[model samples]
Target: MRRYGIQPVASITDDLDIAPLLITSVGRLLWRYRSELAPVTMLALLIGTGTILHSSYRLWWPTVAGITALVAGVLLYAGRWVNLTRPIERAYAATATAFAGGWLTTSTAHGPFTKPLPLVLAIGCVVLAAPWWAHRRRRARVRVERTLAAWPDIAQAAGLAGSRVQSAIVDLWGYRFRLGLGLGQTVEDAVAAVPRLESALGSTRGGVRVQPVASKKANRADVRVIETDPHANAITWPGPSITFITQPAKLGLFEDGAPVRVPLLRRHGLFGGVSGAGKSGGVNVLLGELTACPDVILWGIDLKRGMELQPWASCIDRLATTPQEAEALLRDAVIVLDGRADDLAQRGKRVWDPSPARPALVIIIDEYAELASEAPQAIDHADSIARRGRAVAVQLVAATQRPSKDAMGKSAVRSQMDIRVCFRVREARDADLILGQGMVKTGWHAHKLDAPGKFLISSPDHDIPRRARTYLLDDHGVHTTTERHSTHRPSLDAVSVQALERAAEMPITEDAPPPSREAEKVLMAALRQAPAEGVRINDLMRATRMRRTWVYQRLQDLARTQQAEQVSRGFWRATPEKHAQ
Candidate 1:
């Protein structure tokens, strides 16, 4: 009998222990699903409130109705203050408020247990709960909350143990969070673990981007998880984003839907990529923006026989299509650079202030490698412009396949580029050549860029490796934009014109005969050797070591006698008969 009595007492103690455990488990489940059970909790609260009001303030139905109207009106009119950004969300909130207040008022006026009142409350709860359960932003916010709540485990899996989510926000494309890292952990450590973090967070490859926080705290990182690509499609050109070269040009949209603006004034830019990586399209877009600015004069060098830049010929102040032409164009650009420097020195100014009356000059060189190889003599002039052009508002924008030292004429031109835009490349090492040395190890990864028009930009303003896409300006867009902007194009400023005139009038030597005769001989020889496609007039000028007027005069004399013929619009070549003669 003593043993059995002891067993019963022990059983009573065990039962007491299990009772609290069971209650705790139940409470944990309720809290875990609180958002899903919100409608049920709200219905119960309404019932209790209605019962109390009916017992104490049964005559307050009118006051309740008035309050409901005021609340609904506020929600409908100024719902954004409460984080309701969409009109549909605001309307839903107002309707729900009016419905709940109407049901409560009726319950207060009549008995809380009235026949239709209880049925009406049940129907209203189901109707309102449906929309609340299906809202996208609300669901996203819930997911973010749960993800952050489990961030410690995620961090551990991603090799960032002890890192905690400090704050988070959901946006249209995806969500981002502020991460507080463990001791000795830096933003580089977080960036290096992006692939692991993406796996731990179940995001797609390249979806996780870890950047240093704006405050530049050592232990903080801004982690962005991209659920949708904002630059997936070819963004159409949006006319122009600037009226002057002083402002930054809007190149395209970043992955996070922010504008990729870089100051082009007084800056030399280098754009590099593979042949089909949309580098040409990027150049066209750049020209479209620059052409619209009245304070900019555009020059282009397309050694592919003007196939790429011919569409914008109306807007371009000068376009070069051959090796000799490229040389002459760069040489003239140096002349303009010198002229502007002189003007600035006269006025004691540090930089050239561009205006419609005195516009900036932008020389865009396509296939810079071709220029380096074909016009080796021009590289010295290009190097000079690259070094001294910035202070005088004369800038060079060189586009090439790869900016190797040899490809860039083994000169300082590549080193002088302040803005580097790298599109997709065939090899990983090519990214380093285009962007900088060791950029691949630093996570630029331009080789992995999946599509055309996609690029990675590096400038003084952009230090991180964020992928962006350039706007696409199709053939029709090119035509329309050029036609519209051609009429408004600004001419060469007086300073630049006077400099060229002075250069032309300068004497070659005191004893040398007139240069026109010898220059004509060199020009004719170049034309005879020119390919079937013919040579550009700029090339003739460069070969003859003369000005544009001198080259045109000789060309007209040859054409009138049928010794040379105009093969195309801006191209000339000695006639086959003249070559035989």
Candidate 2:
């Protein structure tokens, strides 16, 4: 083999010691050719020397031939033979042959073959090394593959065990995991599987927890297995395909195989779930179904910049984005509720018993927590509404990410809310709080929810819990439904408005006023002297000149400001704050 120009071979053998020698030899050859360029420059020097010598000696042919060969070789190297390839090599060879032929055809004293020979050979050396470089790259890849293939079977066997345990591989954005049961599992056995897998796979420090899925069906005997990893973040459903059952009095969907249905306008309803647990989508499904009924007026509150409830704004009678707006809305709602209550009371009815003529008002809140946080006034107003709003054909559907006592409040508002919708939470305590204490024993842990939008709905009527499928509400569905219902706007009954206004104005202080100023001064002096425990609306009317309506309105304003608390329907309490003020 011509060591300076021949290609090197890549070895397939494990102990290919000759491969390095071949590479070294090839590198030396390439270096030798690179040095040959200097010889070409030396030849050019000789050509110049010869040309000068010929010029001085009057050797015209010799000088012309040397200059011509130098020019040709420079042009060939610069323009055609820069990169060594077959075409460049052929061209270089042809050019060298032409230079040699020209030198041969010329006089003996003028031949310039020596000048171009080194340049052509140098190009040839580089062209020969191309194949050796390619061969080395191929051999390296093959070695890697072979090394990987030669690994012990134990490495592959570890993954194989997990494959049998995987029930399903759920791909939630930002996370993915194999969800199923591990072998040798119990109710507690499934719980044990996670720690082992976490240890095997090296636990991530992202507060990720492994939880067991509870079986709901008692009668059916099937091998129940629930496997979840923190990596299995959100369970995404295919589309807005919710499985729900509708009845004359109630309509509901199943959450985690638990049935949650509410009676139509039966004390209204409340929903609380953490963000990304499909709270918005769940509400969308509820509203979508409710809007289909012609008798319901949809009112909504979205304190999260209005994006959540804006879609349904056109279909709804009123929508509020700020606490101030919500205050006005609740104020208006109270008015409406009072009017309806009075109308029902006049008809000897306690509640708005559903009839074909009497349509119900459904108020939906997307983020009740935000509303409560921003407007504490609205919270009390909401409490009052929830307490009395249902009797006048008004209902509420509120959803929140945090359903803690502070967010929804435990005392007044939460007690009035009858229905609960629990989604995936970070704690079992949350599931207990939302779904009731029985949920934890049933393994209805919200923290273990594998799917993003999945939830567990619990209501007073549900005998056995049923899993409810959440429906995805796209823009088109929202827009079309809103447009279709644009013509039908729910009008607040005039009677309800008047009764609410009347209720709001109920007398707060017996000494505050009567029908006129003269009688008011008499009651005021009496109150100033005695400072009775609280004021009665009836007593204020009897003692003061102010009319019943005027005295009532002033009392309501006082009660609203907490100057006095409404003790009973027509009675008021003078708080210490009121006395101090």
Candidate 3:
């Protein structure tokens, strides 16, 4: 029985030995064909070496130390490549060279116990490929720079100055300098090279007049050129151009630099122009510039189905599209103004006191005619906001295709909107309505603006009207600006919509019949039991828990219904018809 047990034990030991040998053979075969198997085989070899050293020496310190160093070194080298550091690649190459040399020396010294040479070869191969990868990246960068350098000149020749230009390559950063004529050019050359010089001049109804500022003494080249209010400051080009200024030069400022820094919101401008005269586009430019100011809170109203102003919905705090919405917005603004005025009166503070904390509110309206036509009540509210809103730092900028006195009634609203912009009106009378009387004499005729987005700006303080360029907002600019300031959008939810619907559907309580009609039948029965007069308005209100106005109106309505009569201002008595059968 002992001999039988020993035989079985020996057989198990042989099977265990043969199993490892089979595993090693299969692992070596896999490592020969698959590159991924190199790391796996190295790990297995590390484990086998550790086991052998632990059992033979009864100590695993050397094996553990060697394995740890190998692991840490491999990870460090791999991390360098992952980080894309060129210097680290050089370090890896150096380490690989030293390792190959050390391995060759060790293998020659200890022949049969030599480690795997294939893994060393793989590391060396990866290190050798790094220079080619770095060279390809450098070439790609140079090609992008060359392509971007050519676009600005092409855009200028195409008459696209002062516009944002997009390039196919995103990494190109130095495209701004190549937009216009290069250095050492004369004034004539610069003007001639500028795209659409004639069109730009003719669109403004002004002749191009360039003057040389100074010339370089040694090179005899014109160093500077100035165009006299030639209407190129805010002109829209076919493509994009980088902007250096936040606000475009006002007509007065461009003419003689009078009112050097006019407060845009304080001016309380009104925009009036004919349809397709770029009135909405002008508002877009104004709002675009204003949004960059962190202090300003923009509000917008568009009664033309909201298409013109929806692009800027993200930047504006309030956006109202329908007449009811406009009325609500105006009423809310009026309430805010009144509240602010009351607070200021209490605090002994005045508006326009140059306080950053009390920033102005700018309400911009698009298609004012439609708003007036839909909600006639909004006219008085808007007028009130215009008249008294300025005291509380509330301002209005209303735009309309028709500037007739009938459209925007000739009242305090029109007179109070001091700053006005007129673009391509159908008649000289329309321009007169927008730019005061006889503005056509001062070159403020809308017939002159044949261009789509051109307009003439006129103010009470300016001596003469000047044509100001308008920018056409493309999709990309709108998307980018809106995305950047998306937090300003009004917070609307399903609950708010449902609440609005409920309010709209709710019956007017003043128009509703009194519950006393039903109560009167009971009261009449009680009266039949014991005759008495009708109930007081106060008692009715207290009994029904209705508002005082509602109860009073209901009592007046009851008098009309022949159910009650008011004997005095505060007294009521049941009528004979009401008491009779």
Q: What are the per-model numbers of colliding residue pairs?
A: 0, 34, 5
Worst 10 residues of 2 by lDDT: 167-176
What is the overall TM-score of model 3 with all chains considered together? 0.44
Better of 1 and 2 by lDDT: 1
Which regions in candidate 1 have their CA more than 4 angstroms from the true location?
A: 1-16, 45-83, 97-121, 508-546, 549-581
What lDDT would each prediction earn against the true structure?
0.87, 0.55, 0.55
Better of 1 and 3 by TM-score: 1
Cα lDDT of model 2 by residue, 1-581, tens digit: 56788887866787667878999999876654543343355445545544554445535665556666676666556544433334555455446545443443342344434566445544534553344344432344343333333323312332323223222221211121223433433333333334343334333422223333334322211112122232233333223222121233223334223233455555556666667777776777677666666566677788876798877765675667777668756766776776777677678988675432456777888778788888878887788888887667677778877667788854567667777777677888877767766566554556766665666666665533344446556678777766665555444444653565565356545744424557646544433333444555546655665544455455555556765554433345555564666
Please identify model 3 stretches exceeding 4 Å from their true place.
1-262, 352-358, 488-581
Q: What does candidate 1's lDDT look like per residue over 1-581, in tens digits?
A: 66667543444554477878899999988987788888999899999999999999999999999999999999999999988978999999999999999988999999678989999999999999999999888888888788778888898999999888988988777899999999889888897898999998989998888877768688998898989887778899888888889999999888877889999998999999999999988898899899889999998999999999989987887788889778878888888899988998999999989999999999999999999999999999989999999988899999999898899996599999999999999999999998989888767889888899999999999988888999999999999998888878886787887777677567754533455666777888899999999997767766776666346656766887999997755678899987998
Q: What ranking of all candidate models by TM-score puts the best one first?
A: 1, 2, 3
Candidate that scores best on lDDT: 1
Regarding TM-score, does 1 or 2 come out ahead?
A: 1
lDDT of model 1 at position 400:
98
